[model samples]
Target chain A: MKKIFLILTISLVFVFLSGFNEVVASATSNFSISIVSETPVETTVIFRGKAQSRSYVTLLKDAQIVAVTQADPNANFEISLTGLSAGIYSFGLWADDTAGRRTSTYFFNISITEGVTTIISGIFLSPTIAIDQAEVRQGDILNILGQSAPSAQVSVFINSGEEIVKTTGADNDGAWLYKFDTTSVDLGDYSTRVRASKESEISDFSPTASFKVSKKSVKSKKKCPAKGDLNNDCKVNLFDFSIAAYWWKKSLPKKIKKRVDRKLYRDGKINLRDFSVMAYYWTG
Target chain B: MRISDLKFKLVFSFLFCILFFVFFSGNILAAHLYFKVPENLVGVGQIIPVNVFLDTGGEDINALEIGVDYSRDLLKLKDWSDGNSVVNLWMERPGSDADKLIFSGLIPGGYNGKRGLLVTLNFETLKEGRAGVSLLDSSEMLLSDGAGTPAKLSINDFWFYVKEGASKLESDKKKDSDSPEDFKPEIDRDDSVFDGKYFLIFATQDKDSGVDYYEVKEGEGGFERAESPYLIRNQRKKQEIEVRAVDKDGNERASLISFVPVYPFWNGGIIIAVIMILLLISSGVYIFKKKN
Candidate 1:
């Protein structure tokens, strides 16, 4: 009778233990997955969460793996996404532990708001002017070198004129040079300014650079100024003689002919003879 | 002694039966099916993704059928996908007939887990209103206990509001000329025995018009649309990776990793040479045998 009681007790304990094992084996733990992200995500999004440590985390969109990462020691994971088109996207976060003992799959419903297209105003810097020859002869080629925004179209204007005298594109180095012929321009002082433009954006004109176009200067001839009017006064007097005396014995070049005549006149040399003529015409 | 022993046996059996029922029955009742609808503030014409899930609790669920109802006038079903679902065999692929989404699938050996993703449904807001999403009572979940007993499921419905005045959507239409700022990406190579993959991560800001997207290409392949913290699938030998950051205004900036050698032995040139030598030897043997 004692043996029977003991046997039955052992059997019951075995049955209970086996039942407990079954329950434990089939028991499932709580797995919660949450995504913290701003709704109406535009071009990029970040989804972060905590999961089983060393788990394989996969982010899916339209049934394709868009991004993937692994959880760290603290069971924290983060995924960043960029360049998404404006539309609704069905995304899923699936995590499988390294031991393959557990899996948690969660789906998220998100809407990608249409991104706003924006127009950007570009910065336009003024160009610089560097002339190779500041003073050039007429009909000569003037090399105008300058720097502006890289790859910008530089318009070189002459004499501050509205018309663009020359147009050239700046190289990748932002350096440009224009060969302008001075033949069309009048013989006088001229100034040039340049502006750089790219697409629709135009920069301010550069500082003006002044240059001279040198041509032979012509002198006007006057009638032989009445004997001793060396001072160019209508009446010859002591003042004319004083002016003549100041230039006495001075040799004049062929281009400069004096009007006063005395003995040995027409000679290139200005002597006492020219002074005596001025004295003779003295009315004072 | 005999009478007392008989009484004790009977009591013990009764207690065992009660304990078994108490523990097992609770497991059977824990299975549930529901929709996870995030409270979303959307604009008219905006598309949104919604997910349906099955919480097995502790039960092994083999098959299930779900029916979702939504407002037809306020929303339009755009598309749906069953990829990455726990069900291996699908009895019915998720589809939308007007405003309702119907789905059913079978999982062999049943799925024993806390949660399983069923399907992802995409819907576009048609107008400004509150769109209510709920699971119909006709939805059924079958247990994997071989008898195909129906599992009890609790349904939770949620609402999403589609408003008319979304200022952000209104402001996105202008042209933005500011190029995305220059950025340097961090590249990490994995040579560990378990994972042999490369990870690239970087972040940049576009003050004007916001950043639109990023693109990455390895070797000579065409640029693939990608994002920061992206993974490179190639684990072979040396290759170049180029990444471009593009803003909404079509302005772009790029960064490149010239050469990254993940595996030293996986050389294309050596592989081709070996293949050529094998072909030559095989052809020579075939010709020699024919002559003999």
Candidate 2:
């Protein structure tokens, strides 16, 4: 009986160690990758990346939705945009799960050269994040849920006066949840951001989601928000840059030109000098 | 050999190597812009093909601003090729007045390569004597690291003997047997652009001669030679849009767009829907008053 007890204790220790190793291994395996094609042959481009299985990924150019695709069961996805002129373009992409939860959009600038097909690869979808309550009572639990790559570790950063951090892990289906006890928190506004890391790859930070910690718990959904709002869409992003790009090198009336110059650069032309101002005021 | 003789030989070798490095390293070490011209001399009146190239050494770069000075008296700038250039986009399209030319461009991402082609410039040799092409010191390169850091650079001016007997430069005359490579055109609209009007974007490259111009045609309209971002005369989306890309050699490739059109609100569907809603509201009010 003594020998049997000792054997059982050793096996339990071994099993616990195995689980701990899996966590550590996952933490170390995740990586970040960003690479460009050696030769951009064609004006047409196809973007490939990973998102949650059966989720949808969207491509935005100049602030308009250009294309969207659903990921396969394995979470692999590809989105293509063709008929591009040989020029510089700003593109933004995001992924959405079935629950209407969304990842932060990733923005990039690419110069299209006509001839060869340009392939942009290895993009990892950012994690999705949502809170259970928009106005959580100061002493209640603030529940956060999201989706990410399978078996990834999730870090939640809550900002009040200072920053409070919490950690959780995703299940095999890429779903993660965290419960934060709001006790000892001040009765003020709070913003939360999330990031995910998995074996050999890490995702971008999710967009900021803001809420108030006041007297009662209330449930709501809203995304935290850009400066070059050229379209008056309340967001300054690639979409605005494109609006300017369309007028590139084209002649404008003297009075209108001068007004634009006065507002941005007085160069009286839609040129790089004016673009510099846009870059400076960029909110994204 | 004696110890003194052996020591002298080693010291002499080391000094020679240091001298060579100090004097000749710019050609091999620093990032540089170079021109590939045909041989050392060419006949006057002939087309002098000059291809500009860049070597970034090993650094990734995103932007380049260049200024070129040529012997205006001996050579006149002629046609150029749009194909075979590695430039992603040009901030200032390449142009020349008299003897000086300037251009600037940015790559979306950084470029790091051993030999990247910039442009092919064709200049017609004039009176003949000697001609030269030089890179101005004002030219610069910017690093790709978000921050626009200046790169270490070197330049070499090229000189070629121009002989008197060369014949007139002939044009392939935008005349290639093949049209520009097949390409598609895209339509885009933005409220802040053209006061919320629809416009078109298009581009194409010919492998042999190069693209020269583009023409866009809206429904029931004649094709007009135009640039990208051209405003569409018709916004109704009622007819197919056709775009043509013409090559330097006079070959043309065309793309057409045809899709189902949506009727305007005045076309009557929305009018009837609005009438029904308004009638229902009046009936509801009458019923509510009777019930009260």
Candidate 3:
């Protein structure tokens, strides 16, 4: 009876000790992943965990492999994610060999920083540019417009193959402008491309616009003289004075006389003023 | 059961807790440098307005300088000048006081802020072409605030591009010529106008003699003494007047003469009205004759 009691107590003690050991092992084995980062962006992504893996770990979002690491074996791992957009992510680790097919996966939230939006369509930079007019004359300013991420560099190239003007930034609406140096700019097809960029990305080009600089066109028509034109030649000369003297004293029809009177005097009367006007041009 | 045993247990637990807190309680925030003004693509000659924003506990910033790297064959800088901060124009390396190419003003308080510093930079292009302006790198010294503690942190470098000019010219004529050579002879002509359009003349003067003339022609024979007295002779108007010095080269190099037309108000108006009346009479006469 004594022997059986001792055997029973030893067996019970062994069983209780084994159960306690298993509990400790299970506590260490079971793990969960928690994301300590805000979100994913073009810049960076940081993560932390309650149960981390240092021995041969792989990070995944869905099933895509993001990173593999061998550092921070227990519950802390920092994965660098540059140029990655914001999204949901999951990471997993396996402490066992191929023979032991058990894997631990951690799911966490991540956010990616969205890149800045921009409008850089039609901006030009050149020293000398032609006007859109048929004949761009010298001293005609060329207006170039473009867009960027605001406050971009803009310039105008001159005929000397040099930049004549520089603008610092765009307006609140992201529009930039620069004027042409019309002084040395001749009438020709001057070409330029306005470009803008932020960091590494290049903005789109503005449609190529050209100006035709030429000498001012001559007008075919002329304005009337202050005193009326009696002969009506395009000159204020003796021809006008002679016609006024002919109608000086004639009492013609109302409209006709009025027209004659206006020719003799500036204000419309056949007076001594009419004779004087004729005398001034008598040499003709 | 003894007081000493109880005191030992308490002390051990307290010591362990302090170590854990010391090791893991502090927050590690990241430091980043981002642009403030130009959020993106900027015009070539625009005085690049810039603001360097720092988001972190105050960092020990040492020195900051903005640099632009460009293709020598494509674009060139003439001058850079401003009263306060030095503007460095560059051909290969940036040189100060060359020409009005770039102007720099010191960031108000040297720009150590959480948001950033509003530092305005005005840059003018000497020629139009493609290039880049980079934030480059900044140097800083890490030091403890006080209490004799050493500062510890990592420094990260950042960079961005500044498009000097549009790439259309570069992409199109990339294979034409590397750098701006003498205008191609095929394209170069005595037209005096650039690109078959602009007329460029130089008013040159002798340094010592003060003799001035318009360099009408090119090569050796193009220059004619402007004082030849017959510089401007109008046959129709019988007007002859010698301009003092229309030198087309040297210090007096300048643009050729240009004219704006004069309008004869009264005379011109009368001619137009008369022409209109004559047209009316002719039309009326034709219609009357046809009716008859």
* Most TM-score-accurate candidate: 2
Give per-model TM-scores: 0.28, 0.57, 0.17
Q: TM-score of chain A, model 2? A: 0.64
Per-residue alpha-carbon lDDT of candidate 1 for residues B50-164, written as tens digits (9 for 90 to 100)? 7777788666665677788888889888776553456533334566564457766545335656657777677888998889878888887776543446677877777878888
Task: Rate residue B132 of model 3 by lDDT.
Answer: 40
Interface RMSD of each: 50.2, 15.6, 39.2
Global CA lDDT computed for model 1: 0.59
Ten-residue stretch with the least lDDT total in model 3 chain A: A119-128
lDDT of 3 at B271: 81
Model 1 segments more than 4 A misplaced:
A1-284, B1-30, B37-39, B166-292
Worst 10 residues of 2 chain B by lDDT: B166-175
- Candidate 3's residue-wise lDDT over B1-292, tens digit each? 8896676557656654654444333223334445443434444544433333444344322122333333333234432211111111101123434432221211111222345331223344344444343333332222111111122333443333345553322212111111110110111111111222222222111211122233333222334443111222222122212222321122332333332222345544678998899999999999999999
The candidate scoring highest on DockQ is: 2
lDDT of 2: 0.69
Model 3 spans > 4 angstroms off: A1-284, B1-32, B56-112, B125-131, B135-138, B141-292
lDDT of 3 by residue, A1-284 (tens): 55446545655665566466546644542222333433432334444321112233355432223466543432233455444322222222222111221122222222233331111112111111122343345786655544333444444333334444454455433345666546676555555544444333333332234445566622212223323355444333233432333344454446545664554444445533343333222111
lDDT of each: 0.59, 0.69, 0.34
lDDT of 2 at B98: 38
